[model samples]
Target chain A: MAQEKTYIEDIERTLYDIKNVDKSKYKSQSGLTEDIIRDISARKNDPEWMLEFRLKSLEVYNQLSLPNWGPDLSELNMDEIVTYVQPDAKMTGSWDEVPEDIKDTFDRLGIPEAEQTSLAGVGAQYDSEVVYHSIQEDLVKQGVIYTDMETALHEHEEIVRDHFMKLVPPKDHKFAALHGAVWSGGSFVYVPEGVHVEIPLQSYFRLNAAGAGQFEHTLIIVEKNASLHFIEGCSAPKYNVTNLHAGCVELFVNDGARLRYSTIENWSRNMMNLNTKRAVVGKDGVIEWVSGSFGSHVSMLYPCSVLKGENAKCEFTGVTFASKGQNLDTGASVIHCAPHTSANISTRTISKAGGKATYRSAVKVTKNAPYAKCSVNCESLMLDDISRSDTLPTMDIEGDEADIGHEATIGRISDEAIFYLMSRGISEDEARSMIVRGFVEPIAKELPLEYAVEMNNLVNIELEGTMG
Target chain B: MNKEIFSEIPMRTWNWLGVNEATVDKDLLVESQKLDIDIEADHHEKMVVEYRKESYGIVNISIGENASLKLTQLQLMPEERNHANEVNIVLEKKARLQLVAVETGAKSFASKVNIILKGDKSQADVSVLYFGDGDRSLDMNYVLDFQGRKTVGNLEVYGGLMGESQKIFRGTLDFKQGSKQAKGYEKENVVVLSKGVRNRSVPIMLSGEDDVVGNHAVSSGKINEDKLHYLMSRGLSPAEARKLVLEAAFNPVLELIEDEVLRQEIDSYIKERLENE
Candidate 1:
């Protein structure tokens, strides 16, 4: 009898691991201070009211305390981290007009190709500022405004001022205040009334600087009877030192409108990702979230949705994979505040190689939300004994007419299933990988074609060398 | 006048979804009991313990090898009185123990039960039923620790809350390292029958062995409308239909009392409570 061979191919991260030389034309000093915030505001040419808002947010950030739950953040020091980094390039509306090195980076990341093929618009941000932004002529003709946040603030001041940071206020948490204090480049989108954009708009964020923090604020609004789909993706190169990403996303779906938001975050192992996102739906409106978390040293992300009007609906589908040296705490939150509202949340997590994954969530049905319906399902799979998985869910229902259900399960892969698959002429490694792929198929099927393929490949790469 | 030394002592202090801290009144009398029995082969005994006043009591029991014990506890305190009760039990090899507890009336009630399976092949089963109404408060905690190989433990609780009443239930199943092939399970079901009632349930499972199984589940909601409608269509009044539903929900625990008269008394008490509501 021959022993089974263990295929130990390292998961290839070359596409995201490509780092450029440190050619920042402007860089803020290490540490967070009032002076640093003022300097960032000055560099971005913020208006007087915006500067005041930033100063007030800094005060709030100073008064706030770190969270006591989830992963430890004592390893992150604000004194050693630079709050802002600007690459040696200006914002451009055309890819060909972008700087050579930054354009090459996005080219290698396939951002420009994706823009040409599948996207209705594209915004690429390198480090702290968006370098290239473009939208199709038809979308512009249809009264859709998709551009960088800075441009939107200057051109469409009223709308930008009305919706910025309204959903996720600075007082929401510590990281939210930090984001408000020193936020940088992100995308801003608006669709007019009764206009339905058939294609999806994308924003790609690449943090190329080490020991620096990226705070991007994204605001999207779909007006009454309108519909749109937005996609966001982020990645960073590996470094010995730690990096921070505390971005915020606020979405508004008006009466009878619909919006779908999809995100794929794969930060390097040395990054701490503490992002916040929320959406508020009006009467007869709908909002959907599709999320995938694959990399990060520590992450505490739970996107929230508030159904604020009658007949509003929300759906959330998410998946997280934690390998070695990772603690990913991810889930979703929903609040039903109106009559006849409904929400559904489904999540799956995979942990291996001494990693830890915790699924924490909260669902609240207020007294006014009569006839509200909510269901939450969470499942975690631990591939080895060394790994750990936990689920903690809370439900508070005050309406007698509300219907709520929650279910959670944690376990390891079944040996009997593996044996059965092996007996049917499938290799052990292939069988195990197939099981994992099947575990996340429900979430993967909700993704776009390119992302679904990427998720499948990621599962295969994570299960490469576990056969014994 | 009885001379009493006073000290503020907090009760029900632990981790995981915590309940409100309470202090024991120093002026109340404390009563305790200890029982150690070693029964012979084929020996079986049934016992009933009742608490009816403002008092504190602790009972300890040990079952001998190859013996069995069945215990029913009743907390039937007066409407103006409060009571605190604790029970600890241990089982020997091939021994079995079954416990059924019912809490009906009290201003404030607190109870804790701990069971340990110390010998190989030991087994324990526990069921609890509680009803709260009219500003009453209930706190209950149950822990099962498995120390012997091939040991088994199961716990189930059913509760109903109405009016302005409140209740908290904490159930934990712990499987130690040496408890190979052990199995533990816990389930809790709670129904809130009216507005302003609060019900909290925390079910925990802690395992240190690889070959053991541990599971817990909790379901809290109102009675199904379809079930109620089915009974109402069968010529029963609305109140009668509700009483029948409550009976069916608690029949599993009532059937385990083993005393027919006591079971009937509880059934009548439940009917009376429902009629008042």
Candidate 2:
């Protein structure tokens, strides 16, 4: 029998690669400058304190330098990136009020249908501003605050002011300062004390401008004895010029509360996704993070948790699929600052067609954190010899009572497993696909059924010919 | 005193985490001794080397085709002093190397071991055991660079940290693009004995070849209370039981030492230190 070579096509990306005509109400000039910051502030009608805060963040951004590690980011030029692009539509509560072009984009991405079927509330952003937002009447009557960040600043100024940029300050890193300086639109959710939002609230961000940047600020606070789940979805159309996304997420879980944040980011190949997300848990509180990375040219994202009170807990589960021309560097970090705190992290990464994937993480146990426990496990599968995968994890323990363990492995699909499946009347390509799907089953099951289905579809698109 | 960075991680990360590298302060004018060894084709040899209150600045070893060598090094430093050591090894086709290092005492110690498998079917195995007490600080970097096809590498390190001591351990397993079918594994275990001890571990695996397999694991914690209670039930004092448990942890590498006399000396050294603690 003559052997035949099997070829798997790259991602189709037709659903996410649909570009719209440029009809932005305004576009800030390319590059970072005091003038541009002032212009953005003036256009947004920001409060005086916010303008000052932006200026200070810009100062920090100027003082900071690029990260000395991770993927090569020399190709990113801020001079050619427009810091802000206001969509042609205004923030509205009715989906019919949104511009046809903007609404059509969200329709293609299935945001409205998702909101109508399962989501409790949904906020949709086109380019640099929220075009539409809606919440169920019961949720609103129950005093659950779900709206755009801009509205939160206006109606709930006190709450927004207290927590804005508090967990992730501008000084956290270079990109964080950039996000603080130029952040435009994102979601703000608050679950009141003892209230439980059974259904998940979601926000979808679509960047339709070329050579533009999206700097959204997402803030969620779950009060004492309350529980909530928030999901974030974002993507952009591919362009020749490099697009940037430097968003920031701050989550606060008060005492006896729980919060689960899930995200699936599928940006275009010409994007640089450098986002910062952090959470602080109080006594007996819990925070769960579910993340999936499937796109972007270069990405550096690590969601962090600070266990600040006794008996606090954190759980992180994520998966990354990096194909040709993509370099996704992602992981999780946890700081145990109180006694009896614990954290568990598990992740899977897949690299093929010359792509690169790296898992970087840190776990720190302070002297006060006696009896703290942390465990991290990460696995990587390289589908081709031309690809690269790395695992770098650090653990710093200061007290004898703390227990920490980390395990990592990098390997390719075993020929024996493929052969075993093929002998059972399965094609080689289908067998390979089954193995890859099984590899990510742990993380996929953690997501909602729809998102899990979407992730499976993405995996199939990434391995077209070889996938069932 | 001059200061320099030592035991750098294979891939740098966030500098704020302070795991990328370690800083060592020492006098550059101090001279170090050099040891060189070469094994010819098809030759097998074994040797024991000791460094007592002294430094081995540079050591070079090369193994020819079909050759195998087993080398054991013992480091004993009972006083406050600065020490630094560097070892580099190269292996050709069908070559094998076994290394065992036991370090007991030093006020400030820094060591780096680099091994390169330059030919096909080469293999290397390394085992290390160390103890940190008082104000002592230990920094160690170990690397296995796989450059040939079907190479194998394994590294295991075990240590205890006590008092105000601080230790940083960085172990890397790098499989190059052409190192198809290569297999590498590394693991480190640390036991914190006191409240003031600080332990940092960085286990890295970098692979560019899909056909290769690499793995690393790190575990750090306090002494097992269940085991301690079981030993105490066997008619032993608390301190004695603690020392016995640690000894059991170090026994795997200790049993590999062929020299009974050297092993006895190491045992006595560890016993005295544990008693004082």
Candidate 3:
């Protein structure tokens, strides 16, 4: 008897790799300078305070130094990156009004179809400006304001002023300062008090120009006794030159409110992703984060949550895959500042073909946070010997009344499990794929059905040709 | 009059995990020893080493092929002085080594241990127990390098902290290339008993061989509340319940000590420290 031959196929990313020609009506000159900042502000017609705010942020960006930890970002030169690029169209409420080229890009990515069937509202940003925006009439009648950040800045000035860049100040980090200095277009969602948005709102960002940077600032505020869910999707076409993403997300959950923020980022291989996201929860409020990172040449992202009120809670569920020619350093952070606060962090990572994946986290329980509890669990799988996976977790508890636990494990797939499956009339390659699917089942279950299927397909593509 | 200056400089300088370097007094008196011998089949060796003064010492030992050695080390310097120690060990083909270390008293203590498996089928096991209280600080760095085929190494550390004490632990397992069929495992558990006490632990595994396996796990937190409540309900006071918890945590490392007298001394020292707290 002879054994059957098997072949593994690589994952096809045709849907996301389709690039649109550069059709920008305006693009800022390459490099960071006072002139470029002034030009961006002037073009956007910023308010007096906003102009000053951008200048202050640029000052901070110049004064602050790059981080001494995590993956090195020396290859990312600001001198070669164009800070902002405006497409050849203005904002529109109807999809038919959008330019054909811009509409084709979103259509290929299935944004309009998703909005029509699932999302409550959709804001599509092409390059550095929102090209199209729409919301369900019922949601708008219920006083739920969902629009582009630029419009909200002028219409709802007071609310946007109070919450803009407040949670994650420019001085938080060097990239944060850079984001504040050059941020262009993102989504602004405000759920009214006691209103429940049954469907999730989504914002899609498409970086079309090469050698350019995308700096979008997303702000979401759920008022007292209200609940909302927001999803973010971002991707770019592969290019020889470097592209940068330095976005910021600020979420505010009022008393007894809840917010679930989910993201699926699939940047091109020539991208350097340095994003920041933070949230502050009020009394008895809850915040949940679901994230998936599948692209980028180098990435350093850590979303944080501050449990500021009594009985506040947070839960973070994430998964990251670092394939060939990629290095991703991502995780979560939680600060328990009040009594009875609790946090749970669970993450999984996969590395193969010389890629490196690191999970770094910090959980701090202050002295005043009596009876605070935290638990962190991280698991990593290395498909080949040449790959690397690391877990670095820190717990700083100031009192003896707190309870904290951390557990991490790193290894490869077991041969016995593969053999067991193979004996049941399954091919060896299929068995390996099944095992990998099982490994990420916990994270896939947390996603929506369509997204879960997409994640599984990604796993199948990554596992192809991995077995000898 | 002439003035003499003394500086606390760590012999090794590098970042551990994410923390900075830990400094130690460099002016202490030095003592060193080296041991190399071969043992025949069905033979064994045992030795006990102790440090009692403000001093620095280095001890190197190599076990012969098919031989075994059981070593015990104790650190009991004065409460006001700082001390540093280093140990290196090698195991030959078919050789085995077992080590137990007990750390009790020192204002500031630093120690480094390195073990190498140089021959085929070598094995090593290590156990450590320590207590930190008052203003005392303890730092430990342990590395296990596997260079032989089919080698195995295992390490476990247990300790407790109270008062304003601090401790940092760095453990590494390195499997050299060509050392096929090798395995390494390490675990560390620490219990915090008071506020303002800091505990930092970093466990690393560096593997260069495809057929080798390495793993490490660490956990630091307060004692279990349900266990404490159960003990208190069974006719024990709060202090007694705390003592029982600490005892249970350190019992795994203590039971491995071969010397009864030394174990008794360590137990009494821990009991006195807990009583004062």
Best by lDDT: 2
Over 4 Å off in model 3, which ranges?
Answer: A1-11, A461-468, B1-20, B23-47, B55-71, B86-95, B114-122, B143-151, B172-182, B203-215
**TM-score, every prediction:** 0.86, 0.97, 0.90
- Interface RMSD of each candidate, angstroms, one decimal: 4.8, 0.7, 4.5
lDDT, residue A404, candidate 1: 69
Candidate 1 per-residue C-alpha lDDT over B186-276 given as tens digits, one digit per residue, 9 for 90 to 100: 7777776776665655454444443455666666677778888999999899889888887888888999988889889888887888899
lDDT of 2 by residue, A392-435 (tens): 89888898999899999999877788789999998777787788
Ranking by DockQ: 2, 3, 1
Say which candidate scores most in DockQ: 2
Q: Which candidate, 1 or 3, has the higher DockQ?
A: 3
If you superpose only chain B onto the true chain B, what TM-score does each candidate give?
0.89, 0.96, 0.90
Q: For residues B82-141, what per-residue lDDT tens digits would candidate 3 score against the true structure?
A: 777778888888888898988887898888888898888999899988899998988887
Give, for candidate 1 chain A, the lowest lDDT window spanning 10 residues.
A2-11
Which whole-number lDDT from 0 to 100 does residue B71 have in model 2? 84
Candidate 3 displacement at residue B257 in angstroms: 1.7
Q: Assign candidate 3 its CAPRI class.
A: acceptable
Worst 10 residues of 3 chain A by lDDT: A2-11
For every candidate structure, what is the RMSD over all alpha carbons to the true structure, in angstroms? Answer: 5.1, 2.0, 4.2
Q: Global lDDT of each model? A: 0.81, 0.90, 0.83
- All models, DockQ values? 0.19, 0.89, 0.32
